[model samples]
Target: MNKNIDNFVPAEEPSKDQPITVLMIEAVGKCNAICGYCPRGQGLLGPETNTYITMDLLDKALDLASSGSNHAIYLHHRGEPFLHPKLDEIIRRVREKGFYTFLSTNLISATPDKVKKVLTAGINQIEMHYSAGLTRLPHEVLLKRIHEIRKLNWELRNFGCRLEMNFSLFGETREIIMEELSRHTYYDETLYVRWFEPHDWPSLEKIIDRGVDYRDCHWYKHKACAILSNGDIVICCLDQFSHSCRTNIKDIDRIDWESLADRRMCQGCTQHVEMNWLEEDAIDMPLWLTRKQEIDTWTA
Candidate 1:
């Protein structure tokens, strides 16, 4: 990870006085799906503890976040948020506190009733992840599920809920996934195509048959900070497993995003790599110029 920081320029320092704009809470530490690359699925985090974030902790985190500025709260990190029993209540409470809420799920447990409950609870945005390479569910079945949620979103237009689909590109499903993206009409405006990142315990050769080397990326620190289920505030979501990179959430306000160690960790993340490229403007080529139009058309 340290080797990757060589070419990376640290992101501009954030103002110490400014409030955090994004906060990710690991609402739960367990997930229902056993994806090949995730820490939970690979047994790196051990058997499901069935842990859920208590309302008290949620309130404290919200208070800390609210003290600064208008922020967005991501209700997940490593776990299946829907499994949290109090998911609806969590969403409603977060909304009541005036923070925008986002949840990402595998959509395996997203029944019609469950979907309605969350939308009514005021989830500003929900993202569903689908990976043909890892998911046991059939492709057509997942596509149907996507359509169901989109129809539900249309019906609840008054709430202005947004939906997004993320497809993790892999060797076995690359062509089919692209075909689905190009041919299918998504109800939401953006479809995220992600390259699988390599992790420990999940044999790299098996997980990433082909993908970019993200060792030198450094963009996460500028975006958000993650609060793990154990209440440790890590530099970013990708560094959850590294204890050396964490501090208690109580110390969040004192930590610096541009610290040398944090920068090194960010330099090794794939999400940071993707975000960096998305923000870069080349001399002979302008990327952001077409990013919006391309996304709009793809979503449309």
Candidate 2:
């Protein structure tokens, strides 16, 4: 008798009538850092094996832009996005189509000059990933770079943009870091902490019953569509949806969402370690206790 549990699949809903607003564009194939937990981390899959989505692929995504309410594009999907030389050109093209755009940069190689360039090119928001206060500089020299960029003259602020920090917590003193952040007074800036969940080993039972709330942050699940460089459209980034959740753009006008969602493309997909899936009221214990246990489980 086969006793292996099948993959976790979310409840299906009605098909979408319009295009999802947010689209994740993977612009580059290489990264400057070598984090241990990254998909392109220092293991079987490194920068050598990574491939980037080209301008032609992005053109297709623009053609398929959601004709819905407000269309927003998020750069930096798979690897570090700064590696793309034509990043500014890409942004210009997106804006030319009259769509709002944002970029999630790791801030490793992002210099003040590059920051200014993107801001000038018209970036509405920048979602920066910071590992830790100052100690995690090995992940990338972002902490130092961010400090310098924030101090730019008032002219830089006029680009009309907001900066948000997103940190990945593995094993750290949350209170201490939070206090440090408070002391810095990021000037009412938002700080988001993402819990680490390994893709190779997903906690199914725990995640479903007492884990983080994956549904909350998942805007893509509700509407957005992700276009890979190969012209394959993915529903979400985590599910490894090479099977059915993805559809090739041979005929963009004739996409059949009914059959795509029903396919086993994302059968056993669950949230990642850095992604918090539980809401405050949904968990049994306080936020700290639950988050601590999540870290412990990953560490163990």
Candidate 3:
């Protein structure tokens, strides 16, 4: 597992005077799938709607983590990181810094051989959100790939690594959802089903019906955070619309860690932070802003 630090981002002062437990980085900014439920429309934001956090900026983030943080870094958000040219390098750098790293893929591009390569590269976890039903791939091919990853004991159990599945909540038929969930039973791995939106028509019920725990993965648990390619940090990946900033590792050190956590853009999942002063204000914020009769209006 290449340990060369040639592309390593230098470490800096801890963001909050100490090392944080978890640092979720959106190294790859978009996705390969055009799932109907994708909240952040692909190709609409940056770089074909898939912007990447450059190697230089990532090195800056590594330099910023204090000696105290043993946090695991997740390479996801916005896009498919496996498609990044320097993905292997990014993984190498993070592991070299002694950080437990995770790369969540859509499982569409993941081949068993590719999975083995990443496993050997010191990835602490390899998670996938299988979009078989939502993608254009034929059902047989998609199922085969899912089975392939599920059988990868070499990457999961043998390496003491974690493998998780993220089932995106879309307007899929009930039969499809059940079929996808059942695939987990066929594999020797764990699964995590995440909802696209709460009020998206009995989604909570579907999760409940599946007997899947409804703990909000990114929001409710407060277990998730996003660092943009430019180093902009936000509370939860989904809360980007509320109060996201274009920050860097240096910028993280400049702000009050706790104060920064006081997200003013959108109130994160209710199960996490109690409705605070900032969240309340955000809730009252305008739904739209009018700039010109034709192009300035913003809609939720």
The candidate that wins on TM-score is: 1
- Whole-model alpha-carbon lDDT for candidate 3: 0.50
TM-score, every prediction: 0.68, 0.66, 0.62
| Model 1 lDDT, residue 119, Cα | 73
RMSD of model 3 against the true structure:
16.2
Per-residue alpha-carbon lDDT of candidate 2 for residues 202-280, written as tens digits (9 for 90 to 100) = 2221223343343333433445445554555555454322333335654465444532343233334444333332112
Which 10-residue window in model 3 sums to the lowest lDDT?
199-208
Sliding window of 10 residues with minimal summed lDDT for model 2: 276-285
The prediction achieving the highest lDDT against the true structure is 1
lDDT of 3 by residue, 18-89 (tens): 433335677776667765445443223435435687888787766654332334567776567777777767
Error of 1 at 106 (Å): 0.6
- Candidate 1 lDDT by residue in tens digits, 264-285: 3332344544444212321112
